[model samples]
Target chain A: MAEHTILVVEDDSTVRELLKYRLGKHYEVYTATNGKEALDQIEETIPDLIISDIMMPKMDGFALQSALQADKNTRVIPFIFLTARADEEARQQGERKGVDDYITKPFDMETLLSRVERLLERIDMFQNQLDAEIGRDFSNRLLPDHTPDIDGYELDFHSESRQQGGGDLFDWTETEKGTYFLTIGDVMGKGLRAKFYAFSFLSYVRGTLHTLLEESTSPAALMGELNDMLLNDDVLEDTFATFLLFHWDPHAHTVTYANAGHCRPVLMTPDGATVHEHSDLILGLEEDITFSEVSLDLDPGTALLSYTDGLTEQHTQEGGMLGEDGVRDLAVDAYDDASSIQALLDGVLSQSASDSFEDDLLVVWLKRLAE
Target chain B: MSFDAETASSETVIIHVGEALDFRNADDFKATFQEHVDEGVRQFILNFSDTEVLDSTGLGSIFSLYRAISPDDGKVAFADVSEPVQVVVQLTRTYKVFRQFPSVEAAREAFAE
Candidate 1:
């Protein structure tokens, strides 16, 4: 269980120390000499429960509560009043001010602990609720289509589905050929139906890639055969996907990649940003399609950034394309500073005013082995 | 997107598939199929021997038609499902919704039974 945090706002060091002595065993105690200091304490770290005296110099408890409500950030923190006044009007005012519980001065230690314990329990309940909401949002973020994460790379993913689930998918597997196969694809629709298609498409591609690894070493040939099946025999007409397939040869320190109508990924290295715009035709467009492969020697500290159009399609209030260059700049800055890729994504997403997404965004960051 | 429908019996309808069944053409398929369902025609046989391709949306439309018919103890069959179209059907699981045959005559005969 997490330790409960309590902030006690009182001008008297004696009472503060007393409460700290009394509550220290049950809570992580923070003390403030006045309401101003209490608010400052809260601004830095929101305590699980706040206990404040009604009157203080510079800022008072009522004023602090009002400030908390006015600012969206600290409004939800629970507050309780510890006051000397026993007047009916004062008690009514405390209730109206939304103080969770009130304790009179010279109160019995048992009653005070009971009230504080109840407040902490309520805070714990709310925290669990908040945790559940975060869990739901994270699930929606990482598994929009409910496709299980790639066998070996589950932690390196996040998904956003607009209505049901997005069609973007990624998978990784180490082949018996002493190579690792990484695949990412975006099917051309949304919702459960689109999710089903995305899953079906990935199933076909991943199964075929695994099966073919024993017979072939060329990623381009595998894509060619997969495309042929999709184009010639697949009943899906308008159904198609833009995909990128990669084969990493550990022995040679090289990676071979092929693309089909997907966005050009930015490969960031110490030299600078290299745009890998390999092909134009989408899969399932024709019966006998051939894909070309690009071979590169993996450089240590090299990072490859691949993403769906959803990320690029996000526009500012001014309707500017978040654009390839904008993302490239972020990636370059992050790669140069050796910042985490997730941080780069968070920075870009925070810049947008609205959290609503137009389509699914699938992003992958792969780092080449460092020498 | 163009389709031709023939009423075979009080319980059966035959829809002819032509051109591509894709996002652009799904509306034509939906509009016609909905019209049949609205007309109290439940049983259906879709001739896919000539259809070049059926995308996810098109396959979904086929499933919707089957749902519309199967509830009334009606049936839908596919006639002359070409090899390529059959592959898509198999992948999508839509082929399981109806009895498919090599020729329209077989589909029509199955409907008679």
Candidate 2:
């Protein structure tokens, strides 16, 4: 609460001086003889509040308020009127003009101060709420940060909502047993609710993955256990998350992953593409559902693509499918310039607008680097 | 927010608000009660037992009324504020601004004191 700017408009020299004297104690006060000068000062520095005399030389407060209302920029500014009439008509007229509050002539200092203080406080609270909404939006656009990089192992990520906020996430961590754990998942929906569920799912997986490291290093078994946990949990039952569990041998140049009803992970090479197709059922589908794993041998510069259904489900403006071909073409073109998994994944996603993503999408790409 | 005012005395006004106190419905509330404020009716009983929900803007509306009556050495008291409305009023720190009573008679009695 530094000195708040208050613009005061009054024609009478004595009354104007009194307003300046009293208001200066609590605010950086600006004085204007009439409406014309007041409007000019308003444009120069939009004050926190305005107090104007209803009857002034040349232009009156009502006319000034009308001018302020006519312009969209100044319409919402808080205003209070000072009037000597103290009649019913004058009160009604001020109320009709959307005056925040009014004081009669010969008003006490305390009366005027109380009205001004209350009005200023309300405006401050409203501004704070607007700022919170923006911060929440920004965080939403950069969520679940995980994607395999060009190094074949490190995580990388880029969000369409980086400015506003985006959801899809991928991450990799090594266990105490010296085995690596990799997971990729997408939460349902978008905006604040989607962002909330995405973080919840990520936290559950973090602990679940650590538990799996103690028992087995197999990707398929991890998927089975993860699905069962999700199905049995009450809060998570309503949330549908698609995930892939992976174990890699960096020295042997091999990767094994179990897919849980997620989109097939594509292997992108300069020569062509190879999709690590899904042969298993979706997790949390049923108690008896089984998951499967696919193994791939990597060549240097070969990029693996894993993503949410949002990529393939992108549609054209005329409602035709950007389809599998549009997505494939994007991957093929990107393979030339996108050296890393993060780069390739972002390239394909950037081709389609965020609003066009069919569902919450998360993609992880990893490429074997040159020796 | 609309009010039904009955002059309890030359100096006091009983303003009964019988609907939702909100931005969408505040006109009648203001019009009915503000007329009394303008007449310098120093004491008031703002009966909100009938209001369903009071949003932030609605609280500001009441704040205006409080500011109006308090300056003239008059006080505004709440008569029979509903439980849920009272919860919102308390949560928004507005309950501290108004005097509350369980019944209209209690509020009127307090206003007289």
Candidate 3:
């Protein structure tokens, strides 16, 4: 156990000496004459907690707390305000500024010490929980490199997680000659469990693709097999995922796709943009589910975009959804401008009402080349 | 996390879920539902018209409630499931486990039947 460090800010020398003497027995105490001095002390060495008198000269305690709250580096340090005036307004102001604790003047030394101990314990517990979450999230996060080079086709993919670990996963792999497999999916929840499920699903798909490509490359067959495999995993009973799988053949100039309750993929042609809607339920729901396949001829300069529900379900400023139609419109505009897939996806995100996303976002776009 | 439970009939209790049922409020949701079950309320009508979102944990909590009442032959149905909540329920196949109705009145009538 490390000796906790505490900074005591007080203008009166007598009170400062008393605090230092009492707190020093349990913690390493640092002294500051006023708020200004305390700021300088914090810059030098950030203490575990700060104890300051409210009515000090050369920058009052409120100003000091406000400044500390404004600073990202020192904002999270546990703060305790010592106030001579025990008025409701002062307490309310302290509460509004997010002070950790408050001690009225003429208070017992024992009371102050116990409060400090309790606050430090709470801070330690919170820090442990946060560190564990970050560790789990970091360990589970997966970011694949750029798509592999394929002849006569341009592919672009983008994905963002709302948290440290998100539920969205997308991958593109060339299975054989002129044939590629692309998939995008979203697990039911967020955080560590979602990430684990996503990684497991991705690996299962990849493994199955390798084995099944030798037998059959039919999208419908692949989806059906994958559904059976997922249904066998009883641990995933409470969770589910929406997935879109595409099989592209550059030599044949066609793309066969299967949907599993994911958002409809948008097809952008010279004429306009159209959504490829299918009547498929989400994956992992049942063992005997069947997924139908749809094949489309890849015309020169045609773009197909697949994404998770996070994109269409984005909220607008007025609380309305961007919806599938909005995404289609964006795709149509992007196709008209002939923008890069990355630029088009960026445009879609920029139109989001809030800067913070509530769910993971994934977008994959592929355009056939004119030969 | 607010739960409003109303005695719809002699054996049915309609629990109106408040906004946002997710990981943060899952425990409270389960606890509130369990409290009603403990008081001999067998039939449950979960009204989700006010619920804006429900994640996997929220679904897990509902499943837990279902499991708790299953052995006793207690009934659990959903009413007025919002779009967001319906998406989770449908995707997880939870809708198959619990019957769904358009309104609380409909759910209560199902319990009566």
Which candidate comes out best when scored by DockQ? 3
Q: Rank candidates, DockQ, best first.
A: 3, 1, 2
Tell me the docking grade of candidate 3. acceptable
Q: Residue-wise lDDT of candidate 1 within A4-66, one digit each (tens)? A: 899988887788899989988899999998878887888788888888888888888888888
lDDT of 3 at B31: 77
Model 3 C-alpha lDDT per residue in residues A1-371, reported as the tens digit of each score? 45799999999899999999999999999999999999999999999999999999989999999999999999999999998989998999999999999889998999999999999999889876885576456434444677867777788777767553357888777876768888877766656667777777787788888899899888888889888877676665545677788998887889998887777899888888899876376676545767899998889988898877677668867676677888898888777454555566666667777775656777788888666
* Error in Å for residue A50 of model 2: 28
* DockQ, all candidates in order: 0.02, 0.01, 0.24
Shares of reference contacts reproduced by the candidates, in order, are 0.00, 0.00, 0.08
* TM-score-best of 1 and 2: 1
Q: After best superposition, candidate 2 residue A343: deviation in angstroms?
A: 6.4
Model 1 residue A142 CA deviation (Å) reads 10
Task: Compose the digit string of candidate 1's lDDT tens values, residues B24-99.
Answer: 5666787898998998887788888778766545665665566456657767788888765674554333443467
Docking class for model 2 is: incorrect
Candidate 3 lDDT at B90 equals 51
